[model samples]
Target: MATYRPRVLIGNWKEDACLEEERLRDFMHKRERGELLIQKIDKLQDNLLKKIKLSVTKDGFVHFGDTVMLLNPDNKSSVENNPGECSRLTLAVNLDDISIHSAISLQAPCGVSATKSVEPMARNTFCILSVDGGAVDEPIRFGQNFCLGTTGGFSDQMLYLASDHKSFIRSAKKSYLQQVFLTDKLSYLTCWRATFLDPQLRLEYEGFPVPANSKIIITHCHTNRGLAVPGNFWVRSYFGKEYEVVCHTYLDSHRAEEDKNYWVIVTANPSNENGTMLDRPSPYPGETTKNEFHEET
Candidate 1:
């Protein structure tokens, strides 16, 4: 009598490592998807903005919704690493928001990176709303994008503005590998685009004075996480007027008791004639310098 048996094949070290990496990625993607679904449900169930409130403390901290974010001032060492002081602001959010099952906590720090892990807390939830840049007086057409899932742990939610009461649609995911593996520059740009460029929504301080027919580009150094602090924004007006705006968030030491966060905006000369200058020199060869603006925060 002859018996036939099949032997189990074992994966080699490289194969096993690849498998482990894939599994980790799958787990992260699934978690992000679940969080997004919960956010959508929350949005449908309640008006997030109504439930939440935002205010700056007398000292300098930001009171977002029910959470109070404590801003820690950056030291000289940290400032040297960035273009300006307070380049890297440490924000501590009150955990109360998590208890109410609210999604506002997840979205407030949309593009900013968390310095540490908080138990039972999900990453920030973000959405992008793009609107026609026509005359300010004219009616604007808008679109949105929200985070669905990410490829290699890097994804930006782009949301379109809907006409309904709950006016955001999670339309697509924009993936930038550098953001996931290299730096947070892309994330900062994503937030900037949603906040400053979107004509439908305006941020505090009347947003960044973006002019019509002008293009705004965000540039920064390669940082592993958080914003490319002391980020740069190149704004080129229609009439060939170019301006550089420096954006940085910092904890005001003088107002430390108030626990406030501040964003300093300074305009400077352009780095090149074309008004496009990167934080680091161009990586590609044959690049030439042009008229540009340099802003300090």
Candidate 2:
């Protein structure tokens, strides 16, 4: 008897999205033409299909013990020497899957597999869905929604943050969506709940000095369950050679009364010589100030 493979279905839907509205990196701009967009969409579909295969294959041997076909069978053993390899592969697959899913999510309300877990695609079974090239939708355009897939794997947010070239503003945008924006793949129960709200939690920022007469801001969102729960977050910014730390909190008086409402705090940092840090604000409140600092007075 032949082994079973899982069928992966991904979709795309434009939700009143305009490619031009959102700031596009120069590279994306060159590819913004109608044909290029179609080409990119098709390329994305092809990549996603490849990912589906790799995801299903990484499992090593596909076995149908009773029902479902498992992906990453023996993943632990094969990955022991390569602790992060499996996760990276899974992340790549998920990102491609999520990107494709975002493109077609609102098209016709099509149903994906019942669950996110790897499912069996019976032996000799195959299914493929593709988006044909054409004019962008009127109410909807390309690249409306962005996704990073489930939290089970490595986060694109982390990857972007760790990149040597990405600026704080760039990383912040991606982080906001990944951490705050509500999505089906994201869990409010597990994700939204503030995990590290500590006055002691240290924060740091580094890059370049801010220009004169500018400000920095920080923002934080929390649930109003009350009872402490890490209500404070800290931030640090780099000015020339030294880093300054600022600590703050987001209070919920109603949560104090009923112990039920969370508040998000956005804080700003001080201006520097160049105003690089000024452009990007802190996530918490009261963290910003107007003061110049030098190594030696």
Q: Which stretches of candidate 1 lie over 4 Å from their true place?
A: 1-122, 131-292, 295-297
In model 2, the worst 10-residue window by lDDT is: 237-246
Model 2 collision count: 38
Give the whole-model CA lDDT for all candidates, comma-separated. 0.25, 0.22
- lDDT per residue for candidate 2 within 40-146, as digits (tens), equals 45644443333221112112211111111111112222245435432111011122233434552212111111111221222101111112222221111111111
Model 2: lDDT of residue 257: 18
CA RMSD of all predictions:
19.6, 24.6
lDDT of 1: 0.25
lDDT of 2 at 177: 14
What tens-digit string does per-residue lDDT give for candidate 1 at 1-297? 213222324435555567668988987885787555465446433432222211212322111121211122232334444454333232211112332355432332222222221111122112112222233222111111111111111134322111101113321112111221112223323322212222223334243332211122221222211222222221222112121212222323332211112221111113432221212254555752221111221
